[model samples]
Target: MKNVDIDLNLLVALDVLLAEGSVTAAAQRLGLSISAMSRTLARLRAATGDPLLVRAGRGMVPTPRAEELREHVHILTRDAQAVLRPQMNKLDVDALDLTFTIRVSEAFMAFLSAVVVAAVSKTAPGVCLRFAPKPDKDAGPLRDGVIDLEIGVIGTTAPEIRTRFLFNDRLVGLVRTGHWLLAAGDVIRPETYAACYHIAVSKDGNTVGPIDAALHALGLERLIKVVVPGFPDAMRIARQSDLVALVPQSCVGNHQTPDHDAMSGLASFDLPVVIPDFKISAMWHPRRDADPAHKWLRDTVMDICRAAYLQR
Candidate 1:
């Protein structure tokens, strides 16, 4: 084929002329005068080497070549229209298929996994919720869009992230049922609580937290013998041993706890020293703040957390 340059505008005219047939109607449809349409038709004829439209009895008819090219031009015009159109505003959750990664602590997932899964599955059948373990409080995943949402305490200092309060979380002491602190006649005090071998839960694997600060105010210090990454691990370590695991109240498990030693037959008690309750929150990047599907996810998860954790 010979190389040639053709104005894309001419394709628009060709499509219109083929559809309308009469140059008068085509010109009217394109908001061009009859004389201007005639000039454009002449140019199209010279470029395509075909008088694409010719006079019939009282109007116009498409030439063989024009008819052949009609469908192709129509398709191109439709594609261009789609490309230039605004995005749809509604979220068709049932038709939407996507995998959303959420960063959360193991304890948070353990307490709320069933409700979270059920909510997403019922509303958006094709959506997959990936719950990632929180190894650090870093904002890299949220900033880069690798994590769709974060369900934990909102400690992210990045100014570009947004957070919503889900519920208030309190630290509780967890130990095996027969653990000495829970023995029938023992009256627990800060001094007695501090004397037990302690298991502290910290994401960074450090043996310190707000409980330590509270203890410091009282001129008391607990023996933190073990530091684990999350509540479940702390529970596992404390269950078989005498270590008192400090964790969120929601992380405590009942007799229904499966074979995972982390939560089996664990008993919860009020912390001996007064400590402020921490806020658990849902956080996301501002980049997705107004996205329809993302808004649905954030709203749904927030609702589920409120309904499920209000009891805690």
Candidate 2:
């Protein structure tokens, strides 16, 4: 690449020409006269030092260089359009046609999916939502635009990402109904709870976590019988066996049929140990902070979560 003084407007003309493959068609697409499009193509060729298009039997064909620049040119055009568009007072929710990728924990999805879906459907009918598995709290995906929103505990979020707390979540204990522990207790005591075999849920496969730390405070420890990567998986195991699962309270909803049947053999109780309630928040890149549609989405999601919490 050499230092060349080229007007950015020529890049759009080149993009249109390569896409249409004919000056007349490009001109029609661009709202320009055929002669004007021809002149623009001439300027583009000079700027790139290549006859970017060559004449075929009846139409034009992009040369190798023009083919190479096609995708880049299209991306540049889109970015330029985004920058030049006038800001709107409110998002046109019903007309939104954007795709948003959200990174979230499986626990959040287990509880919040229906609320999120209903809220978004009522507002942005054309918007598509992609949920990416969140293996950790690293902010790389959010910063790089791979993830539009992150829903999880607020602790590890990057300083630059904007976050709004959706709700506070506390740890609770779960077991199969008619379990021995529930039969023996009015209130779960740390000693008996720690004596039970535990089914742990850890994203990274670490069996020990804040739950263990809370137990350690009372000089007790639960023997982890199994370790899984998500809350739903742990609950599944607990529902089938004698193992106890400590999970977020908000996550245990009306059980599915099999689980509902399984529940006749299990029980749920508040954890005897004290762990600080964690804040689950929705985080997004600052670049989209002012986007009307994105702002609407963020607000809608927050409202849904808040309403769900109140109703619960």
Candidate 3:
């Protein structure tokens, strides 16, 4: 058995030597003695079995073999430097082409999809955002790398997952323009609001939530005549029928243009009973905490959410 010696430093020296075409200049460029560089060149010639450089009258010239390896050696060295260097430089969003999978609720996406898409298009035209449904807050997709981001209230997440608060959201009631609730009075009391048939929105088919508990505490309960899988469906039902749909304020949007507003043609009213405002956050795996693209995505989302919050 023969031992094979591998030295990566020789590649760097060879790249400098081929570029400068002089042992003395290569040594000066690499901060090494000329004698040391000469010995390094001898080692490179013996290793590659090629006279990489030869005398050209007053100066040195790269041999055909050296020229062949020049471009390859330069690329390898540059790639190595990029790989080892810290990514502290500014990101080139325009040139970045990437697809990011985000697990988000249909309601939030419906409210902010247009704005988010427009923002990404203006800044990172080549980046694509793939929004997936948030069936449950398991946070498994983030840990498995199946999704780059999970946007919603933090729940049942891994201990190591990173989360950034986006905004605070609370439940709001939605009804049709000529609904009897609006005709009832300026303020719909708990009993009056509860008396109306309600459309319960639950992804997991559970018809009960904090609203129910609050009503129960007051010895009043709303009639949940219909159950839907998501907020969008609830809103649709509330628009056509006389059912009341309770959804997040963010789902209806704080200040959306009429064309982009999800609450268009529908009336949004504050819930009669108090429901605690929950913090909406963007969650990601700890492994992506330092990724430049992931950071940009998070920051962009944060900015959008901040703008929405400010409008409120």
Candidate 4:
């Protein structure tokens, strides 16, 4: 067998042929005459060293080799189209209409929604933001270009994705005011903390976390009576029960209501145990790292997070 070279144009022709499964239909799709498309297919077959398409009754049938390359040809054509499309940076923000899908934690969305919406609207009125739930730190979506941005701790990010630290957050304990734990003392000691029933937020359903690691180091472990999926659920449980909740201090800031009395029911305290502070970051595919619109969006988020943390 001899090595053969293939061109992108032929790849596109092959993709259309595979999809339509007929030379005439492929020609129509590619806006070319049937003879031109047939010639292209012949070239493609020669280049690939395979009889890619063979006549089968009324329509063309893909040979085994062609069938194997069908999906790859389509993927290459789509990627090429994306690359050949007019550069986003060259378009005017006011005239550009595009949607960006962001995967973020509920806590981050609740706190940053207003700021993010305002920032984008001010410069790019035509742009739309689609907020998606980030139940796990999977980088596959980002790598495949399905997710435009990911906001959370940087632990699960892929090595190739570009990441910028948004801010650092420390775990703090929250409890309902007038709770026995608070009434009993001005400062929470490790022993007193370990004795209280706690609500744990484990989206992945894991019992151990940074807080647990810290407690282990101190020779103490809080008894988690309830394990929930999110911080909001833990807060809800903490509001009505004597159970203590360990959460990011920033996560609870946006939930503060207007009623002073209602606000007074919850109190946040620093954990007595030593734990490493986690840095939250915004991550995106490297292909979009240099895009001006994406850059602006990322910078706006970083700025808002910085300001929000400073205000707290």
Candidate lDDT values, in order: 0.80, 0.79, 0.84, 0.79
Candidate 2: tens digits of C-alpha lDDT, residues 1-312: 568776878867877787778899899767799899989988887777899889898877889988899878877875886787557786577887878888887757887776688778877789888878887788876765557888988756367889898887777889987788898767888999999999988767668778889889889999888988878888788888889998886676432211243244556687887788877889998988988877887887888777766454
**Per-residue lDDT over 185-285 for candidate 3, one digit per residue giving the tens place of the 0 to 100 score:** 77989999889999998767788889999999999998988988888899888889889999888777775433234666799888888889988888999
Query: TM-scores of the models, in the given order?
Result: 0.67, 0.71, 0.70, 0.71
Please report, as a residue range, the 10-residue window in candidate 4 with the lowest summed lDDT: 254-263
User: Candidates sorted by lDDT, descending order?
Assistant: 3, 1, 4, 2
Model 2 — TM-score against the truth? 0.71
Task: Give the true-structure RMSD of model 1.
Answer: 18.8
Could you give candidate 4's per-residue lDDT for residues 1-312 as a string of tens digits? 656555778877888788778999888756799999989988987788798889988877889998899878778887896787566647477775777889987668756776789988998899999888887788987876658898988766367989988877777788887788877667878888988999988867787887777778878887989999888788778888899998776666633322233235687777877888778889999988777777778888888887777454
**Model 1, span 123-238: residue lDDT tens:** 89999888887877789878755588998887778988899988887888888878888884545788889889998776665677788998889888999888776677888787
Those runs of model 2 whose alpha carbons end farther than 4 Å from true positions after fitting are 1-78, 84-86, 253-266, 310-312
Residue 48, candidate 3: how far off, in angstroms?
34
Q: How many residue pairs in model 1 have overlapping backbones?
A: 0
Q: How close to the true structure is residue 95 of candidate 1, measured as C-alpha lDDT?
A: 82
Off by over 4 Å in 3: 1-88, 255-261
The TM-score, computed over Cα atoms with residue i paired to residue i, of candidate 4 is 0.71
